[model samples]
Structures are given as structure tokens and as C-alpha cells.
Target: MSTTTPGARIEVRGLTKRFGGFTAVDDLSFDVEPGRITGFLGPNGAGKTTTLRMVLGLVRATAGDATIGGVRYVDLPDPLRTVGAALEATNFHPGRSGRDHLRVLADAASVPTRRVDELLELTGIPAAARKRAGQYSMGMRQRLGLAAALLGDPHVLVLDEPTNGLDPEGIRWLRGFLRRLSAEGKTILVSSHLLREVEQTVDDVVIIANGRLVKAGTMADIKGSPGAVVRTSDRAALAGALRVADVTSIPGEDDTLIADTTDLRLVGDVALRAGLPVYGLEPKRADLEALFFQLTEGTNRNETAATAAPPEGDAVTAQEGANP
Candidate 1:
């Protein structure tokens, strides 16, 4: 669903940011509505970070502008109280305890001190509230950073690759945390090039490639365009009958059909008439990874196909959807 909050609408009107001579965000324009999680996605060098910086006013836009509720981020009254951003956990001070860190930020922003413990406890870091930031684990540090962002009870959240480094459990926790925040009428714009990671977590997605906006819409809207997937009881029978289907699935145990058919009822009717018993009918929706590759697949985007760094290697790129 498109994010729809009464306030905190983030509009990027042709925001262009240049790094030296290169345009990082090339004529980029999109709206990040409030009250939903907007997954900011792209390849490594596709300019996700640069685009976020423009929206936050951390980097000057060489062309257009990004506004938070009709005003720039810096223009907001008590910016931190209105917008909560966590670009990196490492941005915190090492010597301070998690509680102290939040306290300091509250003091600086003139927010109530009572919010410090509440946020620490809310993020499940109450045990480590007194622990120094330098001693915290990656997960703990992330939680601490999140607590800091929530301290002001902000309306909009801007996070850059929030799940950058962590174990599987940590990733899961962060996903739920972000969703809960969005559910509470907070607009969340999380930046990450890893399409697969953000696919299940976000309500909407904005994909950029080669510093240009490629797609921006709800996760459902983007994946819906890719088509539909349906599963039934007869795999081989369905596959044989759907020889001309846009997408079909591999055979699993026990003769179950998994085909990327847009219409399930239609497929079932055809299968029933063809004498194939139907057991299960499910749709395997296209995720962010599949949709992302389709958008940036054949195009050259300055960065090579290396799996380690900038651009679409593996950090945020996956190759699939060629099967039938």
C-alpha cells in the first residue's frame, strides 16, 4: 500500500546530487508517503546512499530538492523531533553508554529526558543501557542506534541499509521493528541496495539504477506487473498444459503444480476439466530481487558484475525469472 499519513510526506522533486563530475542521483523524483515503510533500493553504485543524503540535506543537491512535508529537513522545527534518521550505528560515540547516548541527544534536541529509558527498553536494549557503545555487539549497536532515532518520537524515519551487518536473528528483529514503526503512523524510508533483504520487509519500493529512477511503487504494484504464480496438485500435468505460460515452476515432491500463472481460478478450472486433481493453490509472488534484476539486468551501470562492491554484483543483485 502507498504510505498515507496526515503529515510527514517526503517528496523528492527531481533531486539531483553530483559527486565531483558524476551525477549520483540523476534527475531523481519520487514521493515517500508517511505511515508505511518505503524501501529505498538499488544496486551498490545505483546511488541509494547519495539519494538519501540529498533528502536529508546532508549533501547539497546539484539540481532539484527534497522536502519533508513541504519544507526541507533542516527547516523543520526541532528536526530530530520531527524526523528520526539512523544512517549508521557507528555514528555514535564510543565512550558513552547507550542510555547516556540517548540522553545527550535528547538534551541537544530539547526533548524530554524521560524518553531515554523508554526508548532503550522499547528497543530491547535495557540490559545494555548502561554499557558503553564500544562494547556493544553489532546487533546491540544497531538496537541502540534505533533507540536513539525513536527517542524523539519522530514522524518520519530515514535509515540507510539498516541491516548492513548482523546475524540472521538480528536481521529478523530489525525487519519486525521497522514494520512496527511504520504501522504506528511513522513514515519510514530505509535505504539498501539488497533487494532480497528488503523485499519482504517493505510496503513500497523505489529502485534506482545508474543514478536514474527505474521504478517506484508499492511492492505489490511492482511485483504484480511481473505476473502471478499459482500452485496446484498436479505438477507435470499443469506444466504440460501450461506449455505457453509466462512462468512455470519446477516439480516438487508428490505432483504439485507451481506455475507463474496470473489467474488461479482460471488455471484451476482448466486443470479440473483436464482431470488433474487440485490439492493446493498458492501464488509465489515476485520479490524485490526478481523485479530488481529485471530493471537493471541488461543495462551497464558503470560498476562491474563483481560480487563485492559498487553496482550490481551480489550485494543487491540476483539473476532469476528466466525459467518457464
Candidate 2:
């Protein structure tokens, strides 16, 4: 079932956020196309939540703009009916029942009460709908938060760590659910730390480091072609020979060298010409987890945050939504 408006394009241009002297997000830019699920990924304290907050108009940006359908979030006539966002799953009244929590939000958003029930069932939390929110497990709380996001039936969804507390089965169910929504022409942008899960679920990825955009593209485009790992007794000689053949090689486990090309015949010929004893040669596929670490290796902000504390305002911007 397509939404009334299908889905709107989400554009973030030069989105920057700063607190005091610390720059949380610097000149970030990306787009979430309609009918696709985009994964917003980064290391800890990489300003992901801050960016999302700015996009939702919860936190103002120091520079640039985040827009949906070419209009800023604050300017949307019916914000909830256009974009549904759940930045934090724990933002609920402790004493309120699970069902009541959604009902309350729905009422405030002018949504029909029946929509709440439908979302409750849709998110698979109806069995515990009457239980107090405080008594629910993290997984249940995640489900409740998802149900709340869908209560408006918006064409766009912005979820930060949406699968945070889900079990394997729950995660699988959510994968299918999101795919169905995308098939119905909804726009989805998910911020998550689970690289493997995001790799499987999202149609595209927007990876950042040190509050700057590093990569944004389809999975295949980013991963490129599979390279080969060659183990040899004389790595230096083999590397030199491969370099002469216009192939680059990097150090790998043991005495193995990782060649940047998938042409095994060329690698073998070069090594043989150099008289290097080859032990093992195999294809090395760069998975999402590997590529994520490779791209963000030295850009971790947590390492710095651990030793030095930022100013009061900076601290809040850096630590907000940092919970795992």
C-alpha cells in the first residue's frame, strides 16, 4: 500500500553542528531517496544522533540545513504526518502502559486511536500492550517506540538504532517489515552501530568519521570488486613484482599480502617471474564490517572523549544519544 504522498526526498547539505570549540558534525551532506532504506553509520561520538536531531528540528544546526521534500522540518505543515522519527526509544512515561504511551502521542498528533492499536499489532507488541512501559524489556521498549513512529503512517521514517534491543528473530522480522515499507514507496533512514545488520537491511549506506562524510553509495559500489590474498615466503619481492604489473599489495595476516586486484592469473604470473614461493592464494571479500573499520580506523572520537572532557555544552552534544 503506497502512502498518500508516497515518500519525500531527505536532503542534508553542509549540515554542521558545533558546541563551544568542539565540532560534532562538520559539513555533512547526503540524501535519502524515496522508496529506499539508507543506513546512517558511524563510530561512537561521530555526531550521528546530533545530525538526526538537527534533521528533525529537535536540535538546531549551527550551519546549513536539513530538509525533506525541499522544506525544512520546522516548516513542514504536518511534521508527524510527513516524517516519523524515533531518535530515542526510552522517551516514554514510566508509569504509562505500553498502549497508553502510543495513545497519548497519537492524541497529541491528532491521530485516530485505532491507528495506535493497528501499530501495536503491526509492531508485534499487542500481547504486552497493557503492561507498564517501565516493566518492559529493552526489546519490548524498542517495539513500542517503533509502533509510536508508525502511528502517524508517515511516508518517511528516521530511526536511530532502531534494532538496538531486538533479538535475532525480532531483527529478522524488522528487516522484512522495513523492506515491505520500502516496497510501498516509503523513505527510510536508519542510524545504527550494527554494521552486519545494516549491511543486510539497507539499500544504501552513508558512513561518516570525525563528523564528516567518508562514503555514501550502494553496497556494491562501496565494496568494489573482491581482491585476493596471497601468502608467500618472499612478500617484499612478490609485492614489488605485483607493483611492476600495476597491482598494489598490502600486508595481511602472517606473511600474506593482499593484492588490490581480483586477477589471480596476473598475480600468479608476477610471483612466478619473481621466483617467490607461493603458499596460499585465495579471494578476500571486503565485508561491511571490514570496510567500516578500514574507513574509520583512526577517526574514533570515543578515544579522545575518554581522556579529555569537552565544555558543558560540547559534552551534552557529544554524549547525547550515545547509549548502546
Q: Highest TM-score among the candidates is held by which one?
A: 2
Q: Give residue 124's error in model 1 in angstroms.
A: 1.0
Locate the minimum summed-lDDT window of 10 residues in model 1.
315-324
TM-scores, all candidates, are 0.77, 0.79
Worst 10 residues of 2 by lDDT: 315-324
- Candidate 1 lDDT over 1-324, as tens digits, reads 124323389999888765545566788999988878899877777878767766776666778888988988766666766777777778678998988888887887687888887787778888888889999987787788778777767788888877866678878888887777777788889987666778778888888888888899988788764333445655677777666444455664465555655577767776776777776666655656777888887655535433232233212211110000
- Candidate 1: deviation at residue 178, Å? 2.0
Best by lDDT: 2
**Candidate 2 lDDT over residue span 1-324, tens digit each:** 234448999999999987666788899999999999999999988889888888887666789999999988777887777888877878899899999998888888788898988888889989999999999998898888888877778889999998988999999999999998998889999999999898889999999988899899987777776799999988899999999999998999899999999888889889888888999888886689998988899847733654344344433231232111
lDDT score, candidate 2? 0.85
RMSD of 2: 5.5
Instruction: Report the error of model 1 at residue 266, Å.
Output: 6.7
TM-score of 2: 0.79
